[model samples]
Target: MGNILNSVILESILLDEGETLYKQNEASAYDLADDNGYAYHKVAAWVKGKDGTKYIKTASIASRAQLGKVNVSVTGKGAAGLYEIDSEFYTVGENVPDPESIRNNSYCYSEVNNVLVSNAIYRSGFANLDFRLSTGLPLKQYFNNDGELNEATIQKVKNSLKPLAKTAVSENPPIMREHLIYAESLSAFVDWMVDENGEMVNKVSNGVLVVDVGGGTTDISFINSANEIYMPGSDTVKTGVLDVFKKLKQYLSSAYEIDEEHIRVDMLDKALRTNKFTVRGESKDCEGLCNKAKQHVAKRLNNFIDELVTTTLDHIIFVGGGAEALREQLL
Candidate 1:
């Protein structure tokens, strides 16, 4: 085992070629940090290393996603959770691309690259890493509509990822071994279920609802009074922050005559925060238009959340990347 840097338990487990099975564990935030838990954006972009080798760069901060690119090409996101078993490759960038992938496919090198990028960036340049891995799935992807395990999808996800454990992604990628995959939403709940000593807590005596509005998907999950996940009420919705970005980008396109692709993620963020944008070197106010765009997406999300909110829930928690962006409208 290695020292915990992020929220991951870094143990080495070189599996036999035929032994690619994964074991699931309900890990808490304390356990996460004790095991090297590090939070990173789901976005991964392709860039060249010093030796001209291709590498996938993942950013803990959203701005890093477009670090070197003149234009931020939207790719790989929203393709998550419903991975198709095929040989299709998604383009990472239209300019100076990487051959491997930009697709957010857990079953492919893209997933491996994301992990590698994390290890490289957050590891403080410490090399010779030999850590086993653990990842997660959204609520709908982890469970079926009947509240039972999505056996087929889970198995497929694990099986496909097994071979990549030892597969090299970069010239000096971290040494990865076997790994675990947990339910993304449930992982959040486990944080509340454990104490600072990594022991169980008694705080979860009532029902709680978790709303995770992410960049690509919004997951709604419920925990009953018994501290069990109400599978029937747990699901992943397709509406997320990316949709909000689309509406914002659309407004920028139509109102400012700026191409949607050229807006870039960072530029849009600045515009949203300051309610102003630059055109021909002059700052222009877009406060009203920006609010209108966010409100439109928030309205749609409210319609879906209305059905999920009920009188039985004792506490409601809002989370994920998008939650703060639409904070005023959502809360």
Candidate 2:
């Protein structure tokens, strides 16, 4: 009984007014989140045909399939007398968990996308089960502009998850006993600092800044010398490497007269890597343009980071999907 989550860290962090966020709760008494519920994967639609044909995909399978949503109906927000999600259809393709939208405080585990994700995971197991679910918010939103804990948002997360049932190509899967939420960058920091035993490792006793670069937003979390978060230093920036993908698509459109929708994210990534853009089934070198697009977005991210971080910090860690791509350009 040394740490609340001796198992999950590898963690959970909660902070209040002017206090350090590195919390330690009752040891061995923590609710561990199921990895399937919290993993970031390219999920495909769970499709069901009239002849009882069914398809459930997640991770590489979903990414390979290139579909991320399924039409669903959630019934009655089922707690405190309500049943579950509303009985209306949640539009199919509109639920992609875009990083920029999440930073803007518009996404969460309670969303229909998560429900679909949960359902797919549950159905694949084909067994009755109960598990904890965890999610994160952008660093800046986790702590409001005043550096105070955003209780309202936290409560909103808890409230909106009101026991709901979702049907997406299948009946609602009975699972998810608990829901845990934390800040995006802060979660990164905790994972970096602790081990499976919840013991500190790779110690950074002084200020350490954690940067989480995702698809469309970058979240920054900094813990100062006093062991407390420096709120003024934390932020959720709109700049990210995916911006380069969009810019490149636009570049290809102007150069090749191709529709933007016709080019997918995977194609743009390959093009930037190989310096080739395929148009009309022909590959063309576009290295110079690719570098320009990458640099433009990377520079915007660097500018914000330069202003936020100081030389006095003990460490600066860069993580997330965008980190390695922008590493060559970052300070």
Candidate 3:
């Protein structure tokens, strides 16, 4: 056998046309490497190698299933030729009874390539999220052991509060948290753009902003002049879209005594079909139901926004999946 790698054991075998082999009674033995060894003394069929050599070999042989075609070489031949069978199995290590040996080096090459591709895809997805938050600007990326972002990695987190500054606002701003999943990253992105030296930009200081929505939730941020982010309190609210669907389901069940699962399915289907819930039941029309659901979610969001704006010392920013969807409505 060729010089093998470390403690690795190598095996080689050869079989010819129309040959078969089987294993009989064998005793198993285990080594410190946890690899099992077997002893066999019986054979079931005559076998031959590509070189036309015949041998009984060993009975501790396993079956081989054909995956596809491969090329083989014959002893004392000048050119390689294609072989129909995909794979061959052997019972002995290294030295084979046949003079023409089939090199089985392809297996090692394919396994290593698979691992490289999988790791590349995983890292690419993580980088995409960070780029989206930066609004096209490449930002420093950091990941924890669990692949979550560290709060400190967020740039201009305090500046996200700048949206709370406003004079006409009636309610206090909601308190902002820095560690929410996607929402926080988006907030940091906007804050980095609008806040400069702890002050809101002139345009942002006076105008209301509507954030494009996403899949799970919507984020909203508001800002007005006279309120710098660090000056005082600001409110920020994070609300999930799934919560609205759940509330709507509960309302339909309670008001019309309909089955919750059916209502949920219907509501989802209707929302998908019409992009709005406008179905009517014995108690309410689709429009009313959809509006009620949206409004229910909106009410909570508005309340949070109101608190966040009124209490804060700047502008307001809206973000998240829901906010993105309702941007046109708000505009």
Q: State the lDDT at 218 in candidate 3.
A: 38
Candidate 1 or 2, higher TM-score?
2
* Alpha-carbon deviation at 331 in model 2, angstroms: 1.9
Q: After superposition, how far is residue 192 of candidate 2 from its true place, in Å?
A: 2.6
Q: How far does residue 15 in candidate 2 sit from its true spot (Å)?
A: 35
**Number of the top-ranking candidate, with lDDT as the measure:** 2
For residues 67-148, write the lDDT of model 2, one tens digit per residue: 2333223543221111124654332222222211222345544454344344333323311334445556667656778888
- TM-score, candidate number 2: 0.66
Clashing pairs in 1: 6-36, 6-37, 7-32, 7-36, 7-37, 7-38, 8-35, 8-36, 8-37
Per-model TM-score on C-alpha atoms: 0.63, 0.66, 0.34
Off by over 4 Å in 1: 1-59, 62-127, 159-172, 199-202
lDDT of 1 by residue, 180-220 (tens): 66677676677767864789874655578888776667778
The better candidate by TM-score, 2 or 3, is 2
Tens digits of per-residue lDDT for model 3 on 184-270? 333443554566355655343443433323323333433344322321223223344555556667776676666775553434434
Better of 1 and 3 by lDDT: 1
Off by over 4 Å in 2: 1-104, 109-127, 163-167, 269-276, 285-287
Clashes per model (N, Cα, C within 3 A):
9, 10, 56
